[model samples]
Target chain A: MKFGVFYEISVPRPWDAEKEKTVYDNCLEQVRLADELGFDYVWAVEHHFLEEYSHCPAPEIFLTACAMQTNNIRVGHGIVVCVPEINHPVRIAERAAVLDLVSGGRLEFGTGRSATWTELGGFGADPDVTKETWDEIVRAVPKMWTQERYAHDGVCFQMPSRAVLPKPYQKPHPPMWVAVTSPGTDVDAAERGMGALGLTFGNMAEQEKKVANYHRIIQSCDPVGEFVNEQVATVNFLYCHEDQAQGIATGQRLAQTFGYMAAQLVSAREAYPSRSYASFGLLPQARRQATAPGEQPGVPEGLCIGDPERIIQALKGWESTGTTGVNFLLNVIETIPQEEVLASLRLFGEEVMPQFKEAPDANIRNARA
Target chain B: MPIYGTLALEEYAGAAPVTGELANEEWETDQAEALTLSYEIDDTYRLEMLPAALHPSIPLYAQIMVRSHGSSPVGAFNLAEVRLMTRAGSHYGGYTIGAFANTTESVEFLRTRYGWAVSLGDIALNQRHFGARAHVEVDGRCVLDMSIVHPQPITPGDFLVIAGFHLARVGSDLRLIQSEPSYEIEMIQRGKPRLTSIDTEAFGDVRVRPQNPIVATYLKGSFKLGRVRYLIDPTRPATEGTEQI
Candidate 1:
């Protein structure tokens, strides 16, 4: 079972410069600690122009910097907007190959068509063309890696005969993954032979059906990639500690902030132009008005809030989905203190992680026999 | 099986060049109009299309682009077509779109500079474009879209540069270009029978000069019959790249 931490650089409304710096500095520090603790992967999301919510616009650069500080943990592009407008296929191929080379094959290429209007519109990409653009780029990267001096005269881009050189360290290119917000995409990823990074944020019962459908399609897929890395992974809000009540108190507000902000960004496109990068599209009327006396924004579901024993019982449901890994979205909105984040990692690693860690000897011993 | 091929033209009969123009003077707006042009290839051409089920093992599309060689300078378009044909008494597949490609002299720009070379045994190339010397493949007969634009003031020699390969050929070539790689010209050809070379440039930086420069191609086999060529409307720009379902 692989373990990773998901980052959005989230900071809730009452923003300050120092708080922002601390969020990132703390995140980098958390990644360093995670590496020391034997975490498998460190993932970062690539979001653009969503001020206050996500400042990780230049994720490739951040991942490159992360590559230096960590030795064991794999660096990941949790999701690089794969549409041609946001990043040309050639550009994506070049960046991914360079990172794979730098990381010594410890890179996983996760791709997606943007869900928010701000990013998609900023690049002048047509929503109608998003899926096709995603499919073409995803299918094209492996070719660009293997082909010598490749040129493509497709609907999106045309290049003259020039070798796209410096192939990746991973054979047949780096591992391929696609972010799926909906269950339909899970099956699409399986059919295309890409790992499913399900960010649906739902219960174990929902995930079970999603994973079962994905496995069925994967069994018959003629992958566009070099190899079939049939794996499914998911992310959930996490704040674990020795005392269950304290863990909940520390995680609740920040988790709610991350959840609420993500939904607002996606839903805003319906009311205004998604491509209008200047505006976040959050109209005054849409803002959550002050409820009657003491109420606040609704609490989000699927959040893991408890001690090791309770968290373990909640996570057992994840195994039912047959997922290979689960990324913990910690430190959302910076509600938890830096020390608390580190302690949670320690407690979770000592008690919770041991149960899920895949024995290194299992695969080797099976192969040798 | 060979998936697609192009028709030989005794006289190059085709459409106008591509010009980047907006639907309106909507300044700074993201909306832009895209057009596509298409052509059909005959049975004599050698190329094959594998079934979709055999994807990574066999790439689904072989993309090509076309540039202006006359007074009219049409922009680039991608070609992907699927067709059924009979090759040596067997059914094969084809995919073609409207686009332009570089002549033999044009592709050499990639290899001579960066020592870039494609392992053609793995991908498919048109015998009409690469000639008999290059390792072009074909298992069955199929149709393809190779968009070749003829700019205005039609002259004897003019063409666009075409590059890129199917999955079998993407490797160090992709990496080098991404990391500031260069290319050189190795071969040049005029028409279908004669071939030659000009000069080389960085693989990523091949340009079409003076609007209409004469281009060349090398044919793999001799043809006794005639093939179809397309002539598109000058006002209509070619929209021939990838299309979302």
Candidate 2:
């Protein structure tokens, strides 16, 4: 299966003026290294006001930097929050097109409604209507990119007929995806004919069921973009080393730190109960896996967080789930040193990546073809 | 790094009376009806309300619950509590700020057995044609008056209630006891929350100014207070200090 690096750009507290800058520089260096190592894509998230968890409020700016610095790696907005107050549809279409043009068409446009009240409430957006707003925005953006001019009087926003300019570098526009966090979101993606971008770390059986449901439902799907992006990519943590124990120990620190920080944020369902948010987003799962009394947290099954052979076995299990790719979180709060992270990436690239034969963008190519 | 709570453990421990044993037995309740109202509070005081072992929840909020027990070992009683949402390490739970019960026996049972910060109060939970309401009074002053207006029927599964964290003096040590109650819900309803009155000072913290009303729920359920499975040292991070009981 194809592999990619995902970034939340977590910056720990007691921030000096240069801490965030150093983190960004280190991430860019990682991206450059990944590109050279034959990694396929680099994804970044859009989050807000989440201290010590995610400082990446502007992923477009970050992804654009990634695209400019790398030649072959595709830059992905792991998601742009589809709420109007956070991002107007036309602006989203316009910015995405510009990025696609600048990146030489190497853009995977992912979309979702922000799942936390820390972000949604900050924007004064209504939690009850985010689902409707996301549906409207996703539909309207594809049309905006394809048509000569677009206009709509929709529930979320009204726009007079105007050319949403700078059409994308990709022929029918870049592939579309939805961030699937809660249960049944994979179905939502499949029905819209978008890629299912799995954000939660479920077991192999759970993932297999979700992938099965997605494939079953997409046969008669209506495409949201020019063609259906019939693909599934799940998220995992990666920290490969020659020594299995050392790699696992470091990886556990990364995982636990990430889980700890994630729990500190307020999810939409926790703060505001609504039918729009079906589950408590991703925080509770992370919280459940946090450190308990007198016991060390064990590595989750099928996680890519060990030596080359172990990671290879884990990825094979994921491949059996019918997933197209794996997007890995490489670090959290800079818990692993930068040099170690780079070495881990290099080792994974040299040892683990060669074991898989599928082209990184094979699904996208086939869908377009 | 997660933000730790800044409440002084020594001062808090000194104020609390040593009651429950370190090893306590589990307790269960009969059929119960509860009215829960939650509201977003001023986050400036979030950290101050919790001990060092905990972390303030993002978008700081508080829950006011008034529950009426149909039958218990201490006979029938009405209970009310104010809890600040917090994170014990990574688990989401509420930290008890103040608790009031209608009966002396219930108060004594809760305080001496579970280390609840409970006192005697006049409390009532009533159901109206429109919805449900709860009123709590202490020292002849109305401390809480909240309601669920025009509550609409909702699936029992939709109501997500978190666990409660009580600071108790357990066998000469001040520990943060985890009180998780499992509810077998029979019926549940949701409605717009209305806070008619609240004395923030009377609840032990004037900084708990309710800014936005989140939700109100009324549920008929049989709940069992499970055995205390964990405790946390109030002076250290929960990750480094939690102990299995």
Candidate 3:
């Protein structure tokens, strides 16, 4: 499986002027190191009003910075909220095209409707209509990227026929993906011929079921973009050390800190009853993962936290599930010191990554061919 | 570390009266009907209302639930409550702002046992042809009037009701007691929420204004309010302060 670095950019409270700046600087430094380490992608999330949990409201700007600082790593604007109140489709298409152009056509476009009331309510966007709006935006954005002039009168937006400028450097546009959190969303991604960006932290058995269903359904998919971007990438936390015990103890801090912050946010399904938000998006799983030290018997199954050998064993299980890639979150609220984080990255690159290097992009190349 | 609540411990202690003793026995109720209306509230006072042990929910919201119990330990009664969504450490739940019950027996029993900030009030929950309506009056003045509109049938599992945290003086210390109840839902329906009137100050805060109606649900079920399993110190982070009963 391919490897990638994912960032939530968590900033702890009592913020001094330098806190946010320092966090961003550390992230860019990590991104630069990952590029040299042969990491395949750098992914950043778009979250607003989630203080301490995520300070990254503008991922496009962060990805642009990553693209500027790195040479080989692909830039993934993993998800731009498809709500019009937050972003107009024309603007999303335009910004993505520029990022692709600047990055030499290394972009993976991920899309989703915002899941938290903290964000959707902050923007006065109706949760009931977000699904419909996302559907409209995803279908339209590709047309904007491919068609010389795109126009539409839809439920969420309306525009006169006009040329959408700066068509992407890639022949057909960058790969498109859907953020899959709720159950059955993998099928939604598969039906639309988009990549399934798995966001929930589930066990190997659960992931195996989702990946099998996704590969099965996509055989008859109708492409939402110019081509079928068939891939599955899941998220996990990483902290590798020479000593297995020390690595797990430290990684527990990173995981617990993130889970604690996540529990404080009100998901759309929790605050509002909507058929649209079928499950409590990602909060419950995150909270469960954030167990206090010694609360759990051992590292939960499938977590990439331990010595390099242990992480390799866990990842082989993920590979057996047919997922194309795994994205690792490095830290939360600076819980792990910078030097250790960098060392972990280097260790992972040197010892763990080489084990699964063969045919990393075989699926993508096949889809394109 | 998580963000700690900013509301002073003394202020939280003074918000409600001290209870008698922690109730050890679980209480069960017969067939019940409930109407729940939830709305997003202004988050400006998010930190000012909860004690140091809890974390305010992002984009703070509140739930107003009115229920009619067919039979209970205190006999049949109607109860109405207002709760601010919050988190105790990594657990998601609600912090009681205010509560009211139609019968004085329920008000006394719940307040002394579970630490609910309950007082006597006039409350009614009625099922209509279009949907369900709930209203509460304190001293003959309307405090809450809300309804569910265009009801559509839904599965019993689709609706989730979180637990509650009540601040009461347990012994000499102010504690946030957890009251988690399990429900066996027989029928449930989801619908658009409509609020005709609400006196926010009556629920103890003017900042609890409802900006947007999220959703309304009406269900028929039976519930068991279990014995208190945990207590938290109001002056520290829940991770460090929570204790098992």
Candidate 4:
């Protein structure tokens, strides 16, 4: 499977004055390394007010930095919070087009509504209207790129029809995607005719079932834009080393830390409990419980968190399951020294990626040049 | 190409300090023991149940009853606290809206000591393996008879956070006090609070008539006060209260 690096830009607590710098610098360096090592994309997440779990609030800024430093690697907004409160639709349309122009058309516009009350309430967004707001912004952004003037009478945006320029360098618009963490969101993404960036697929069997369903549904989905991006890019942890023991050890440590940090950010019910939180936990309870407590927190069975040979074998199952690409989250928790993370990327490039380079169907990607 | 380079990203210089236990496996904190059952009421209810003194952006009322086992100033207490979701231009935590405590000790300790608007009441907090029930009566009038069943177990990844907020008082001048305590809690469950009854006349304009209560369970907790940040000191003049934020 095709692989790319992902960043939540996780910084552990007990912050120093230089914490932001250390995290951003390491992240930019990773993007540059990924570009040189023949990686596909450097996907960045947009999250707000989540202490340590995600220090990245402004992903466009980070992705711009990624584009400036990398030549070959595609810079992705794995999501821009698709609500007017976090970001306005017009501004999102403008900034995305600008990034596309700057990055030489290497942009994958993934969108999503903010999940936590800390984020939604912080931005004063109505939790009830978040999904509809996401739908409007995601649909309208493409029209902003192709049309001379864009306007909507909807309450979310009351723009007087005006030229929404300068258009993206890509002919129609960049490929659109949605961050799918909920169980049926793969189907939802397909229905909306967007790429399914599955954030919480637990196992190969589940992924196989979901991916098959996603493809089947997308064939008949009414497109939200001119073109539909039918692809499944599943999120997974990646650590490769000559020694299998070392790889799994480092991988599981960071994986567990990531899970713990993610859990802490899962909206505190005592703070802002609501009925809208039914689908908050993406991975099923039964699936998560199967990993046994002592093993790493989110290391589901048969993931790409091992040595070159092990990772290669594991990916074979994923590819057979109809997976298009794997978003390899390369860093977290600040425990893995920056240099060691760099080394992990280099090793994956050298040993694992080459095995799939010659595969007949790598990915029929939206990387339209 | 260089148009966006001129802009600076939003950054927080510092944050309210909390234990990093939930984030890292190596991170550890002293566990506190308390039993709490809370309910989520409507925001309009905050206009009455929550003190207007807090000037909360949004109000959350919980029919919280507690059995302080460790580090909690001894004894059992129930508080129908209307908490502000945010205040003073930051989300440090929720503040005491309006509170009622069963024991005289808890009422005075929380009110006179911490500036909470705690009053005396008759209350019960019953917690079982499967579910919990909380009942309250203020001024010899039954106020709350709520129960929450079929608790959904909370996984460690989604941990319970400390309830942090400012306590406002209007006696002898307007006083706003940020309480000095950090809570360390373990084990939590989520369920809906079934409200049997609520009378707003007894609690002032608080019309908290909800069919479904956002019920929650938190247990095994301790609290220790860290450095307290004072926006308004009771000893200070009234002018100081509004200027602090």
Candidate 5:
């Protein structure tokens, strides 16, 4: 499986203007080094009004910076909120095309409807219409890229035919992806013939099941764009070191804070806003843990943490799940220093990535024998 | 303590269905004048008042005042209530924290039919030349009294953003009580609201946080209650050629 680094660009409470700059600079520096280290992608998110949990409302700017600074690592807009209110489809099309041009066509246009109540409610965008809006926007953006002059009369926009300009450097357009937080969103991506940008953390068993369903469904997909991006990418946390103890302790702490920050924005669980949110699973997982007294809650085994051996073992589990790529969330809650983060990336590239990179060729030879 | 999405059906449940919709489907209400004032609340109120099923993250407290002369199960009357904004995962929902009406029948209709934990109280949202004011008093104590002025009116969206889900169990189906209230709003003005009176802990003990009063909108048109829908996540967000219901 291909290796990529993901970013939420979190800045915990007691935040100020300088803290945000430090976070951004640190992320950029990490991206530059990851590209040099031969990492495949650098993914980031777009969230608004979520406070310190995720300060990245505009990710296209950062991705553009990545494009200008790095030569190899694909810059990913892990997602650009697709709802019309949050961002008009027309604006997204224009911006994405320009970015792809600058990045020399290494762009993954991932899209999603805003999940948090703070974001949805703040923008005055209706949750009821988000799914419909997301589908419409995702389908329309690619056409805007390929077609010389694009015009549409759809549920979201109605205009007399006019040219949507700045077609990308990619032949048709950059590969399209949709962010999948819930289990079923994977199926949505498959059916629509888009790439599945898996946002939720899951174990090998869960990943295997999800990926199997995805590959099965994608076989008959009638794509929204001209071609299907048949790639399955899932997220994982990474903290690599020679010392197994240090890696687990540091990585797990960062992972806990990662979960906490995510929970803060979306967890109205056990409250009125979360009445329908029970399906999101974190609360349900916690509730089930409450049932079995004295049992330590299972840290999601999907993350590639621990020393090189343990990290390789964990990643091998994910590789068996049929994922095309693994996006590793590198720094969370600022628990790991920037220098340590760079060191971990360096370690991952030097020791772990080579095996996975060579495994496909080895597998082909074994099949032949 | 982690406040993300949680299943809140149980928290919102326990209010007996008063609409009698299961028995009959002839209940409809249209043409009403109302004023709604919304506020942002602290985490304390968000955790305490809303239940786990709701996955309460956005702490919303709204006071709605209505005067209806049109048609409904209650014929014609005046009523009002306080709604707390909630969410069931991604879906927006609300709880009737406290409610009050001028008439006794409306009070019973609200509680027995709509499941609002309402008590007898005075509620009004009035247009006073310069601005609009919302005042609510449960029993003898004033719970909500806030106003906004310099009515800089604009075209309101087709529907008000204030509506949310009312989680109810009708039989075995987990019905997400969806509300799409359309307003023939002749006026839509947004501005800073000034709270002159200060008594948040008078009524249901669900304190109205005095800090951040976010955005306020005043409407002068008729309101219509839309049809309710069943709340099913479909176990996944993927669609298999299934048309949206």
Candidate 6:
């Protein structure tokens, strides 16, 4: 299974002047370290003008820098806003190609429509049209890469025959992925023949159900993409230390805070009028409102806090759930230091990755049964 | 050669306080949280912040503006590298922030402030149309400081013209007060008024508008409409003429 990490570069309220530089430098160092550590992929996100939650508004620059710094880990646009208003398709192609070339062909193009109303409104994008825009632009990328000149006419965007150069390293285009937070989007990705970067924010059981649903859909998909890339990836909070209690205790509040923060931000623009409306423990509160309090968050739910063994157990639950890959969300909310984050990565790579490091084809075959 | 579609955004410095998060695992959450905090706490709004070394330090601002539904030669009257200019002053200043886009959604189209050229990588437009263009003026003088579709699409039908421009952070918050449009968004939407026309005797020599026009509509940024052109920059003109192409 492929492994990747997500970056937000948060500098929470009561900001320190040096916070920004430190976080960025540490990130750069992490990418360099991941490269040497035999990690598979390094993914970055693209966000615009949001305080505390996200600082990396321009992820391409960061991704490009990572491209130059590392020789292995496939750089990812964990997502580049595909909406024309946020980013035009042509620009997406150019940026992806440049990153691919700079990184010597290691680029995975992940795309999505901004879910937040603030971002949608800011970019002048129609919230309803986001999904459609993502599909159109993503489909257009490959054609742009392969053909010297092509033209398009659709509901939203239209282009004439023109050469789009600096094609990506992967033929047709780099590996394409669609970030899906819901199962419907997962099935939708499968329908389009795109890899499901499943952002299934649920327990291990829910993830398994989602992955099972994806596999079924993919097996029957006509496949819009060049190939049937039916991989399902899930993101889980992670923090590893030699001392299990220290890892859980130190990471508990931070990990829970991270989960609550992520859920709040995702639901914010739709939930409340302002960001301060984000109260701590909102996720748990929302869960309580929706379900029984005694219920666990999910198998892969809550923070994967503990020693390496516990973390492995959490991941294995997800693996059984049919997850093709895992995007271990280390450093959630920044309670841990860089040293710990790296050590966690090293430990996971050494202890966990090996357990699943067989031939991917074999794994898929075994999982299929 | 890497043919880049270079364009410019005039007068309006796209957005304020180009904020960015570091590239770390928490990068996603940090950015989302920080942005949410700013929107919640700060009274102002920011636009078009994409990471780029275009200006070494300054981030690229994605500005959306209204344009005609046709192919227009996209270029500015002039280009230069100015330290910084704004609505209130030459440097740190104030702004009359206005919201643009469909009413149901709080969409704000970014306008240009200064005359600066930018490379938007090459792109093409299809299905052009006609319509009235949206304007953001300063002191009644039409600042050529907005995004003009130098290389836009040419077809038939009104469009919700969208373009991008360069900008720098002005202040923490530029309080926006929305007033009635001096003209009318509906009229522009329905009547489809034409701003600067091509093929005119005076502007004929400019090669201003290509034979076709770009359609302006509220593209929902949807992908269901398969194989659509997300962005179009006519500035990086095709090597061959329209007929040949």
Q: What does DockQ give for each predicted structure?
A: 0.01, 0.52, 0.47, 0.04, 0.06, 0.01
Q: Each candidate's TM vs. the true structure?
A: 0.55, 0.95, 0.94, 0.64, 0.64, 0.56
Residue B172 Cα positional deviation in candidate 5, in Å, after optimal superposition? 44
Q: Give the per-residue lDDT digits (tens) of candidate 4, residues B129-201.
A: 6676666788778876656667676553344444344334334344455554445555556565555665644
If you superpose only chain B onto the true chain B, what TM-score does each candidate give? 0.18, 0.95, 0.96, 0.62, 0.71, 0.21
Ranking the candidates on DockQ from highest down gives: 2, 3, 5, 4, 6, 1
Candidate 6 RMSD computed on C-alpha atoms after optimal superposition onto the true structure: 18.3
- What digit string (tens of lDDT, one per residue) describes model 3 on residues B115-167? 89888999999999999999999999999999999998877766777889898
The residue pairs that clash in candidate 4, if any, are A263-B157, B32-B220, B32-B221, B32-B222, B33-B221, B193-B213
lDDT of 2 by residue, A1-369 (tens): 778999999997789879999999999999999999998889999888888788898988999999999999999999999999999999999999999999999999999998898888878888879888988999999899999999999999998999999999998889999999877789989988899988877789989999989988876677777888889999999999999999888888887777777777778877666777877676545545544532333346677888999999999999999998899999998999999999999999999999998765545533344
Off by over 4 Å in 5: A267-278, A281-298, A358-369, B1-39, B42-199, B204-245
Model 6 chain B: worst 10 consecutive residues (lDDT sum): B28-37
**What DockQ would candidate 2 receive versus the native complex?**
0.52
Residues A29-143 of candidate 5: C-alpha lDDT, one tens digit per residue:
9999999988889988998877566778888998999889999999888899998888989899998888888999988888887666567666776554677889989888888
lDDT of each: 0.50, 0.85, 0.85, 0.64, 0.66, 0.48
Instruction: Report the number of backbone clashes for model 6.
Output: 86
Candidate ranking (lDDT, best to worst): 3, 2, 5, 4, 1, 6
Q: How close to the true structure is residue B68 of candidate 1, measured as C-alpha lDDT? A: 18
Q: Which ranges in model 4 have alpha carbons more than 4 Å from their true place? A: A268-276, A281-287, A290-298, A358-369, B1-245
Evaluate model 4: give its lDDT. 0.64
Greater DockQ among 1 and 3 belongs to 3
Q: What is the DockQ of candidate 6?
A: 0.01
> What is the DockQ (computed on Cα atoms) for candidate 1?
0.01
All candidates: CA RMSD (Å): 22.8, 2.2, 2.5, 13.9, 13.0, 18.3
The TM-score of candidate 3 is 0.94
Off by over 4 Å in 2: A283-298, A360-362, A365-369, B21-26
Residue B193, candidate 1: alpha-carbon lDDT: 16
